[model samples]
Target: MKKYGFGVDIGGTTCKIGLFETTGDLAEKWEIPTDTSEEGKNILSDIAASLRGKMAERNIGKDEVEGIGIGLPGPVQPDGSVLLCVNLGWKEKNIPKEMGDLMDGIQVKAENDANVAALGEMWQGGGKGCKSIVMVTLGTGVGGGIIVDGKIVSGAHGAGGEIGHITVNPHESVPCNCGRKGCLEQYCSATGIARLAQEALAQDHEVSVLDKAAGISAKTVFDAYKEQDKLAGQIVEKFARILGKGLSNIACVADPEVFVIGGGVSKAGEVLIQAVNQYYREAAFPSCVHTRFALASLGNDAGMYGCVKLVLE
Candidate 1:
């Protein structure tokens, strides 16, 4: 008989699940559509149902699994209740209890999605063999996770790694969902990159591919950059500059050995990483030059692998 562990990443639009063997290998992966009706309670129930369906399809008994780990989009309390998830439509819910009930007595653990991704990188991805690491995810919104001494370092209230919410421009505030202004996320995420490109085009009115797109997106900008579009190059460079500043701020405090850049935008590869690395080195404090920047080894599955780690390690 083979032993297995389950990893689930619950996002606003889809839920990703993976089964891992005891040997730290991914055995199977699956996904289900997320239904956020009722502010996420529906999504939670859907996840429970989907888990059972997957287990049945795989012919696996619940007892054969050691535990289940979940990576969520909101702040998860140390006790496993989801404190708040504006993106997921959850507010003050006992996720562990709810999911555990659906599991019928299985061990279930939850952590913020970004934190889970950080743990995944630390356990099996880019941060392997390193005890301290920082992971920055540049997606629709910027997210981050900090790991120190092989454990997630979520400060009191589980807000320690909310790096995106950090204020970049104290004076020139841009509205944030958290009721703040000039947050790093507003300036560095994929959305931010698109916004920057839009602003550039708005000011210049140049003849660029991005200017013609009905919907401007980070991917469009990146593709434009690859084709040597000067405007797109400018957008990418601006992203690097802002991202580097954010990393520098984080480095000054956490001083991690490596910074793992993840999310869809990271697919831009060396072009993006090199640009950010240049800025990070330039802006970082002189003593903070020891940090190495790497792309996330695990892609979308990082959250699932992270969830598995949440249970085992």
Candidate 2:
């Protein structure tokens, strides 16, 4: 068996790379600026060069390495082809073939960034010790990854875990970035939460601290909620209701053993978890009602760990 591998998570700003032992330990990690110039043509070559340098510095042979696993911020088909990654300026391409060729016969696997993060959490973070798990990332937008029996259910079209796009409201006039209306992302994401706060404050002259705040943000809302401010509590409850219901809907389909919440919004801590869980319980199927909820522990590194797991798998 190969003793080492590389995990690469490509983002619009930076590409995070990790060297890992097959035993699941990350031995080294680093980052490189994403050169998205010329439609991201330099991105793969840059990663290949960096990996070669690392291997040479460590006196490691290709035979000693398992392969490279990459998580891209886009939809990755089951065959390791990426349809498009707008952030990376990537069009349709086979990532595995491209990266593998540049890496001199080493194997390569590719997956969507969110799914890989879920895999990472299940393997070594919040969902560790669980065979089935759902990971929800509440960042600028909401992202999700579903894992069943230790493998990602990436779906036939690579859209398996797009939980954020689920329609939560039919009357919403504002369309989502996906050109859809009333997506869960419009209610549960950090930006969405802030937007909600703004709308709530606008609807009525609510006597709340948020009105006097210089800026409104998801963090501000959570902070205000912590202070037991009434208006903030209302906004948070609305956010929690939508998120919890969205998760319950996911549970009905995937029936995962655990739900791992991560991303910027999750930093709100136990309060967020408890609030979401309360709604999840109320909405979840009886059999799934007891599914555990956990905050993601790996943070940004979750993708890297998950990439390694992909190669190891």
Clashes of each: 1, 0
The ten-residue window of minimal lDDT in model 2 covers 199-208
User: In candidate 2, which residue pairs clash?
Assistant: none
Model 1: C-alpha RMSD to truth? Answer: 2.8
The TM-score values for the models, in the order shown, are 0.87, 0.96
lDDT of 1: 0.86
1-313: candidate 2 lDDT, tens digit per residue = 6999999999999999999998888999999999999999999999999999999999999999998999998888888988788999999999999998999889999999999999999999999999999999999999999999999989888788899999999999999999999999999999999999999999875589999999999999999999999999999999999999988988888999999999999999999999999999999999999999999999999999999899887
lDDT of 1 by residue, 195-262 (tens): 89888988865588887888888888888999988898888888888889889989999999999989
lDDT of 1 at 27: 92
Point out where model 1 deviates above 4 Å. Answer: 35-63, 83-92, 204-215
CA lDDT scores, all candidates in order = 0.86, 0.94
Q: After superposition, how far is residue 238 of candidate 2 from its true place, in Å?
A: 0.7
